[model samples]
Target: MIIDGHSYCFPPLGEANGFPTVQEHLRYLQREMADHHQPVWRLRDWAVGDNSLLAEPQDKTLQGLKEVNFRSGGYGRFVWTVEGEEYAKQYLPPYLTDLSHPPEMLIAQMDYIGIDRAVLHAHPIFGFLNDYLADCVQRYPNRLFALASIPEWKIEHDSQGIVNEIQRAYSKGLNGLQFSVHNRYRYSVTESWDAPACRPFWDGVTALGKPIFFTICAPCPGSTVEDYLSQLRIWQGWLTRYPNVSAVLTHGFPWRLFLSDHGLHLPDALFEPFRTSSAKLQLLFQISLGNVWDYPYTQLHPTIVQLVETLGSDRLMWGTDMPNVERFCNYRQNLETFRTHCQGVISDQDINNIIGGTAAQLFNLGDSQ
Candidate 1:
């Protein structure tokens, strides 16, 4: 089973009438699978969250704006229009009244794409989390698991409460934690990740000994490509301090550091630091949003292939970073593109590692080694 380590199916929130019903979302996914001519069972979808679809109109609007600001800050410009709205509406539901609310599009997609399991995250705590996980697992048996997202602000005030929530989720068979580097609630890139306040949480996670999936955002204020390189250097040093911690970098380390559309043209020297340090960390690099496929770059396929060759497939995984924002292509398309490009450089066994084996091992899924 190929497990997509990171992916999403954000429920729509707000006055935007264009949201697809839960069933609609599934249906659309089925259509996508059929279009690609891939068997559904070959894929395992991890549905991480921005469950704003269940939020009130005002909250959704606020989150939408935040999303816009984040993207604009990173990409420089963005245009949202009726066409985009209409497109979104075609797939999203207006509201998610309950955790079991089945958006038609998603149902369709799941039917077509063959989502064996799903993991949910995002706001409004207990109600949705409990309901959604129960519903999905009931439907799929042991296939579905929930990944808890705790309130960042409350980590200091109620560390025990947060730990309790994680323990509770795990007791319910939820696999691990799902967090983004830019999580609105917690230590965003704007804050130094190594701050003393966050150390205890890291310690807690290490104690759990479960896999931690984190997104990496680029171009943070007061930080440049060089700064990112420095951060990685620091991270490499930090990893050695805690031997039990294992991480998977959702987007390649230097993704945000690329300055040109032609990825290869970007100074190759910048990558040397990552290449040198990455080899030493118990980290896996994933090709997701902000990765080679999303950006317009010349000879991107070759560049990606070369990177895989250098990094080794055992240290790489595939992620789609779905629904929250569509990258240049869909999940299946990206995988196919990668496979086509790396055919000569990577063997079938290596491809298996990238597609699912590596993730299965990283998360200790299925039978233990």
Candidate 2:
């Protein structure tokens, strides 16, 4: 069974909600303001991946503002829309943030891609609304696992402690939590992974007995590589500070891709501590794949071969960051890169670990490990 560590579904516009079309979202926003009787779910409140994205593009003028977009600075590059109209049209494909992609749509895609299951989360920078994610997973219990998102906004705003929010999400049957050290967009708010203010939040997750995963990407625009490395160190401190916590480090594919072309090593300062602590703590690495074939030619990036050699296949895992990757090719073709590239470098057992076995062991899927 292939388990994709990173995959998402921002259901196609819900016809009931008039989604994909802005009328439904506007209606909800209007009603939310008029009646505050009970808690109202505004589209942007928890609809992380697509709310603002869907609305603004519809505005004839704001479409021109894509030029002013700011992603997190450090190592995050600045993107100027040199090619205007052409870029806007290709910026985000309609299906990715579509209004109709429901659980069934995902199941069909899974079957076509030969993926048996996936670890799920909301879109980057948007807060984690596991309720919607949980519903999707529940409908396809055999195929999806929902990871609760840390409400970065709430934690920053509400002094009541995020423990309650974390507890509530876990009580609802969400499996784990996902946060990133590297903030995706300039407007995205993220608390430090090792902040003292987060003790209560961390303790709450500790109680749930589930692991936390950190998804990382290199070349953060404003920050230096050291800033990115500092984030890794912060996570390492967590592994040392919290003995029971298991963490997954992801999107190492960018680093891998960069290294293969540049001939630089994945700085030992960052990789060594995690490697040494594996026996004493739960720290694993995950390799992410998206539509990189457009630039780096995407066939397993040789970095995985080096990583498997150093960390061992059991310590490394694989993920296909889907929906976003569909722009490259269909899902099955994505996995084909892995199958063909590993030819004789590592044993089949090693390949199994990267594909699904390691996650089964880490997430504790019975008998599958």
Candidate 3:
């Protein structure tokens, strides 16, 4: 079975609250936070309509920005606002005004890509998107699996709230918990899940025996590499203490770090300890188009080869990051490009693990029928 180990799906168009589009979400944040970063994300970029990549050749704004994984302007972490015309840009080739993909659309796309099943990360919305995801899973249980998202405030401020949300979603049959809390300035280290206020929530996650997934990446400005690295340590601390749980490093190619301002792609030495930690660390490689990371020298494929050799094949998985990168290349291209990269460096058996076999086992999707 060809299983896409990592991907995402948005709730259908009209199902959105205020924060559905990137621009609206940023506008909401700007209104809420009386902070320095607000202007950087709000006034100058989103409001002014000055987007470098959006103006580029792709014709699809969100998809192109996402295709490059929003490498600049704090857009990678969804910190920057992408408004009106920008929202028209799609990761898919067609110029789309509505980014919504109901279950049928997602299923059709999956069918086209030859994906038997996929583990989906729900879109982070104004309210809990779990119910929408639950409905999708219920409607197509064999074809889709999902992880639920929690608001950053709830995860940081309300411990019981976090637990409640998780329990509710789990009871509804969501597969795991997902967070992309990349903004350290707003959700400082003290307010994170590892902190006392949220410890109960982290404890509950371990207790529930569900896998955890999060995306942590360095914000472009007003934050340093140390700030980002510190959070990674905090995340690892949780993995170390709760040795029984499983978690994935889901964003920014943190598997390797963009160390130094010169754009050097080197592996973070701090993550070296967790490579063999008891808590399983599976990496979902979600680049757009090819077996490449825009980084210097080693694209993600070579890095995956290193990771597979070091961490063992079971510890890594392939994912297209779907819909988001669809504008850059066809789904078949994403799968095949990695296959091309693995041709020389990775053994065919290990390649199987990185692509689908390992993820199916980790996500417990059972045998592909």
List the RMSD of every prediction in angstroms: 11.1, 10.2, 7.9
Worst 10 residues of 3 by lDDT: 31-40
The digit string of per-residue lDDT tens for model 1 on 230-336 reads 65555555465565556655545544345355544345553453454332111122232334434332245555566556667777775543432232444455445
Clashing pairs in 3: 61-89, 63-91, 91-327
After superposition, the stretches of candidate 3 with alpha carbons farther than 4 Å from their true spots are 12-15, 18-95, 125-127, 183-190, 219-224, 252-264, 268-270, 276-299
The lDDT values for all models are 0.44, 0.52, 0.57
Sorted on lDDT, best first, the list reads: 3, 2, 1
lDDT of 3 by residue, 1-369 (tens): 677767766643333342456554433333222221111223344443223423332222122232222211221222233442222122232422343556777688889867788888754433347887888789899889889887654654676777887889999889998776643323334355467776766777678888877666554333556767777777777777877777776643543335343333546554554565743344444342122343222355555656666677777677767765554556776776656656767788877777778778777756635
Candidate with top TM-score is 3
Q: By lDDT, is 1 or 2 better? A: 2
Off by over 4 Å in 1: 15-138, 141-146, 184-191, 218-223, 254-256, 259-261, 265-298, 324-327, 366-369
State residue 165's C-alpha deviation in candidate 2, in Å: 2.0
Q: How accurate is candidate 2 locally (lDDT)?
A: 0.52
Compute the lDDT of residue 277 as modeled in candidate 3.
71
